[model samples]
Target: MKTKIVLLPLDERPCNYLFPQKLFLHDDIDIVLPEKLGDKKIPAGLKEIDSFLTKECKDATGLVISLDTLLYGGLVPSRIHNETEDKLKERLHILKDIRKANPKLIIYAFNIIMRCPSYSSSDEEPDYYEEYGREIHEIGAAMHKSHLGMENTLPLDEIIEKVPEKYLNDYISRRKVNKALNLASLELVKENIVDALVVPQDDSCKYGYAAIDQRDIRKAIIKNCLEDKVLMYPGADEVELTLISRMINTLKGRKPKIYLKYATEAAKSIIPLYEGNMLSGTLKYHVLSAGCQLTEAYEMADIIMAVTAPAGNMEEAINQPSKYPEYYAERNIAEMFDFIKDRLSEGKIVTIADNAYANGGDLQIVRFLNANNLLMEVDGYAGWNTSANTVGTAIAEAVDAYHFGTTERHQNFLGLRYIEDLGFCSMIRQKVVERLPEYGMNYFDVRDKEGKISELVKAELEEFIKNELSSISNNLKILKLIMPWRRMFEVDIDVKYIK
Candidate 1:
């Protein structure tokens, strides 16, 4: 018999919905999703999701849900929702009823601690955030410090005077409701309605509104003695995939052991941008969340994770100097490449977690892999978005490969990461963004997703692969490419690989 798991993704984005489905294609697992998950900024139909969960979960063996979607429509809507606290609580009760209907279903759920972007942008925030976003973030940090009786570097009163009272009040009000929802989800774990729960801090920092919420959530977990059943970490988009790996491991009674290999020991202590904790701290939760253990002995490990940490401070892919500075000169890529090579020779499932850059893979790492002809030899690779996002994704793929072994689908996924994470993010995205002004477009508003901007990107990527990444060019072809959300931030790519 095959395992059937019903998923309610964080949103309708490809990372949340499509990635999980593709990962399970070669396995005996059936991942069932709701018919309609809505668009960016637009909430999915609550009635449709509830009905789908109630129906499909009855026969399913497990359920992986994003509580943000169930409580506030979707991730973006969670930030701007105007629904009252009473109404949101009423919606949360729906989970209890589902548990009643499917008594035997193993429920795994996650909720996000709302993010506070350092820069001002209304693309995924309120209309007022475009103007006061940075000020709002500063104000939140000041307030959090004041509440804890810490010294305030930025004058809170001065910053607060800049924004209108109404918008600040509105932002604080929504955060209160969302934090309450996070606590309520933990109660589900205490009640055994949810077998496991993860409350991911989305795009977090060391001191801010999100960190304050994380502290409160941690207190509740300890207070209720639900420590083992819940995990709070610095990740958002990749939690669904992590839970899916856990579910598969549980079904097969497999707990894979993973050994961490960092480019430099200092990389473990350095906190990547947009996150609160160090890379090592987050990796522990990610490994455990996927139903895996970290091993000290390489000979006893099932997966060898080659983590490419930054030399010193991490920088965005576009801003990196053509010749990196001395501060960014500590990473020993040649040594890391050799380690991967040696592991692959020993028939180990080696995976690469490229965290050397913020928004893309390290081009140097890609070139090394290509030069050594190890691009497709490794089991998994991911380096996009935040460091936690890349680490969680890489760990999930490694877990899947460990259990199922390599397959044609696995090879395609590996190729997709190289194309999107390395090729588009590091190389093509900057080129496309530069050309956007010529086409009367900007980064946020690319006009048309499949128009000239995308065509330019496709052409540049083809040239880049042929010239730079010829190792996998013959087997990989771009089947489709579009700016998902019609922005230069990310691209939705479809590719075909022969081997």
Candidate 2:
């Protein structure tokens, strides 16, 4: 019998962009989505999500319940808020109600990810909240305008002082949300409301918010819940999606082991690693960003890991525009190279991809990396450095473009970060999970350090590769390799998109 799974993503953008729809491409899984969840509305109704659990998911054998989606109104905001007892309690009641209706169905739930609340503008403006107090006041005014339509913008200082302690308290409540979600995940299991929990490995979610470390809180929740069934799986979004899909394919006839391969060729254009004196802070953010370790130390290696940000003027590269003139003149490539070549004498491998954001005299960064034998690129679409989104649709299109052959679609890019540290891994994992049914793999449960995942998630990852590796040649390998490397580790490269 075909396995039927239902996925209710908490946020609209992530729900549509990365989820089961993309995950099931490699499998024959039948994934069901509620009509309300699909509505163009920004916030998926709580009632709508609950209706699916009671009405639609009632007959399904297994279901994945993203608590973040079910509560907090939306995904980003839910994670972006401050946690409090009241707020946490409010969301938990909703989940409790859903579990009361279906005690037999296996439910996989996740605690909401905590994130610092901040906003960005597409115009490339500096994140003003860090620089000026007025920008924050403006935000408060906008909020007031939206809710109360107050005239005469309140004085910035007045608003700061007058904003109700309650409202401001709610705005910055990470501690409460963390506690609430932790308690809910455990309580649900204790109450037998959920069969398993799937916690994603997302620590940065709280970096911008309060000082609380969610890692510890999640571990405690896992211990309190039944350890046998409450598996604490370690996976990001991208990894989760792939793992989920792998589960489905295993049930199908796909083989269980595979290796990733790159589709592009660069015989004549190999970027040789520069073997000379290494510059402390020169030759690409790709290289500079990776400088957390000893620079002189890396020069001695056969391969060097680089982290280049978007292309920009050597001026912008050397100094922040916010501090332009003081350090601006130091942006000379000749001067920068003089210091870098000395370290290159030490054998190193420099990985790179030209970022599109830097303001520079020319695209010399890639040329420099190439001239010095220091370029390795990963395959994937990458326009944003910190905000890389895997265009699953684009990847699907690329797959179709190549007739499922990695070599056919040679035009690709490398990831700036390593696989393990990438934030986008979760998104990719979500997509992979959504696609499981087609491959006949059943995700009995999925969890991370946060919750129902066992310590065997890595084994599960290996199992996934084993199952789907042969189905599409090295497609999974390439996707898995490129997706995380660029997102987590920094490397220098020649040009942004090799394709």
Candidate 3:
């Protein structure tokens, strides 16, 4: 049987839509992502997405969709859009039509519990974020703490007492709109319009809108007896991947056995920045959420996950190693590597979840893999923006390995991971940040004075990226290196040899 899974991503970002499709590209299963809405922009792609579903989604075996895309055009527009409640509700009714069309499809839809970023940059949020972003988060956090019955909940009181009433009302009104939409989604799940639904709080903190949103969603889920089908948690981008993985395994009659390992014991307790929980807790949630079980005995596992994380607070590593001492610390990786080396030799798939430092992989670890010629030995490698990002993608790769892993394809995937995670994020990005100053622009604000960004860094990026990739992949061709977000924060590299 040919398994078809249609994905309606929150946006055209590679992580959001591309990674899941890549993971689903095995022998019997096919992952189909509808044509991206626009040229990676927002508020205009809904017609195209709807057209694809109306035309091409008939035979799909399963669907993993983002409601943000269906209603508000994309995730970004969901936050910044000025549409009214009546308009949003009218769009929400489309789910009923979709269900009437494909009643038998195993539908797992998700909606993000909107986030209040620490610093409002408008890069992906509303325009008022720059001046009032932090304050808004602080106010939400304070209210959240009080709801939790915490004693030190003075911040909320202070904000309510001090801040302008208009700004506070504006923030509250927007959150109210989002919360209503989330409930409407849960209603869809309740009515069997969708099989399962997730409401993940993106960029969460302890006492903020994220906490409050989770609390409300949890109440609704329990009230409606929808615990088995509806879920609420602290995650954003990885939710789609988790849902896809679950559906894939359920359809295939397989529950992947994963052996999880951490870089250091200390790393488990310390939460990486931009997340809500400890690294250990987050990994546990993702493992089970993906319909995979964690195992203690390494020998019985289908995939060995060796997570590389910081010994202390994880941060972006600059050239100075002494400042980030965790990078230099020998966390007994030698023994771990040897164990993995033995497993690979014995035909077990070994994968690395490199959270050694957020936003990049540890150069020490990358260099270690390169020097020992273990690049090909490791079945998969993922070190991207966050530990959740790395772990989720690596899990998808491991599941793919269990079903469709090949030596050529395995090395090809690793080739792309190393070039992007190791080359661009850690090495080339730093070089670009340093070089940008000479051009009279700050590293963080590298866009032109007119807010336009140039692809001038491709020439400089290709030199080092190609040199490093040559050391790793002989057959793989580095087709292009372009910055998707126009900053050094992320890269969108194209490789032709993977398929």
Candidate 4:
């Protein structure tokens, strides 16, 4: 018999919904989801979700849920929701009822500690955030420092004066309600209503509103003595896949041993952009969360993870300088590739976490792998978004490959990462964005998702693969491409290998 697990994704994005399904395509497990998950800013159908859960949990061996979706309809709505505390609490009570109805169901849940981006953009935030987002972030950082009796570099009073009193209050009030819900989720763990819970800090920094909330959430976990049952880390979109890997491991009574290989020694300590902790700290949480252990003995390892992190400051892939900098001199790409080759020779499942840059894969690394005809040799590869996102994604794919062995789906997933992460993000995205103005379009609004801009993207991607990745491009073809939110930030792609 196959294992049946119902998933409530963080949102309708490809990362949250499609990635996990593709990862488990050939496995003896089934991932069931509700039919109507809402769009970018539109909230999901709460009644549909409630009904789906009630019906699906009857015989399901496990349930992986995003509390943000259940409580506020989706992740975006969680930030701008104005529902009263009583109403939010009423929605949360549904989980307890589900637990009561299915006493044997193994429930793994996650909630996000909302992020405050430093830039002033209302793309995924409240309308007023377009004007006050930067000020709000600065004020939160200043207040957090002052509360700890630390020096404040920001002009705290001036920044506060810039934002009107009403906007600040509204932001603070929404945070309070969300924090309360986080605590409520912890209570479910204490009561055994939830078997395990993860609270991911999305796009976090060391000192800010998210970090402050993280501290309070930590206190609650300690107060309740739920350390083993709860985990808080710097990630968002990848947590569900991590939990799904953990669920499969638990069901099969397997805990894979992973051996880490960094491109440079300093890669472990360098903190990537849009994150709070060092690479090593975040890796610890992600590895353990995926039900895998880090091993020092290579001979005893079930998987080898080659992490291509930065030797210095991490920048966006598109903004990288043509001439390599002095700080990156220490990253030995040759040695990393040789190590992966050696591991594969020894029958080890080697995976690459290409996080040398933010928001995309390293072009140098991709070129090297393709040149050596090793693009399809690795078991897994991911370097799409944040460091945590990349690490968690690689870990999940590696875990799945280790247990079930790599299949055609796995190879296609590896190809997808190469085309999307390295091809589009690093090279083609910028080229196409630069040409968008000719079509009277912009990054946020490309007019139509599959219109001229997407066609331009497809042409650019195909030409890129033909020139840069000739070894694998002959066998690979793009089946479908669409900008999921009608934006240039992310894309939903379908790729297949032709015989």
Candidate 1: 10-residue stretch with minimal lDDT: 320-329
How would you encode candidate 3's per-residue C-alpha lDDT over 86-133 as one tens digit per residue?
778777676677778877888888898888887756567666676678
Using lDDT as the measure, the top candidate is 4
**Compared to the true structure, candidate 1 yields what TM-score?**
0.97
Tens digits of per-residue lDDT for model 2, 265-360: 111122211101111112221111111112334434323322233222212221223243222332344544443444345422222222212211
Query: How many angstroms is residue 390 displaced in model 2 relative to the true structure, after the best TM-score fit?
Result: 6.0
Give the TM-scores of the predictions, in the order they appear: 0.97, 0.43, 0.89, 0.98
- Which has the higher lDDT value, candidate number 1 or candidate number 2? 1
Using alpha carbons, what is the TM-score of model 3? 0.89
> 1-499 in candidate 1: lDDT tens per residue?
6788999999988889888887665557889998888777899999999899888988899999999999888999999889988888888787888889889899999999999888899999999999999999999899889988998887889989988999999999999999998998888888888999999999999888888999999999999998889999999888988999999889889999999998888788888889999888999999999899999998999999988876567788776543554224677766777777888999999989887788888888888888878888889999999998899889888987887887777777888889989999888898878877787999999877688888888888888888777987888888888877888888887877786
Clashes of each: 0, 118, 1, 0
Candidate 3 weakest lDDT stretch, 10 residues: 448-457
Q: What is the lDDT of residue 142 in candidate 2?
A: 49
The CA lDDT of each predicted structure is 0.87, 0.37, 0.74, 0.89
lDDT per residue (tens digit) for residues 1-499 in model 4: 7789999999999899898888875557999988879887899999999999999988899999999999988999998989998798888788899999989999999999989999999989999999999999999999888889898886689779999999999999999999999998998998899999999999999888988999999999999899888999989999988999999989989999999998888878878899988888889889988889999987899999999886777888887642455235878878888888999999899988988888988888888888888888888899888988999989988988887887888777888999999889888998899988888888889977788888889889999889877889899999999888898999888988664
Model 4 misplaced regions, further than 4 Å: 321-327
> What count of clashes does model 1 give?
0
How many clashes (backbone atoms < 3 Å, residues ≥3 apart in a chain or on different chains) does model 3 have? 1
Instruction: Kindly indicate the candidate among 3 and 4 with the higher TM-score.
Output: 4
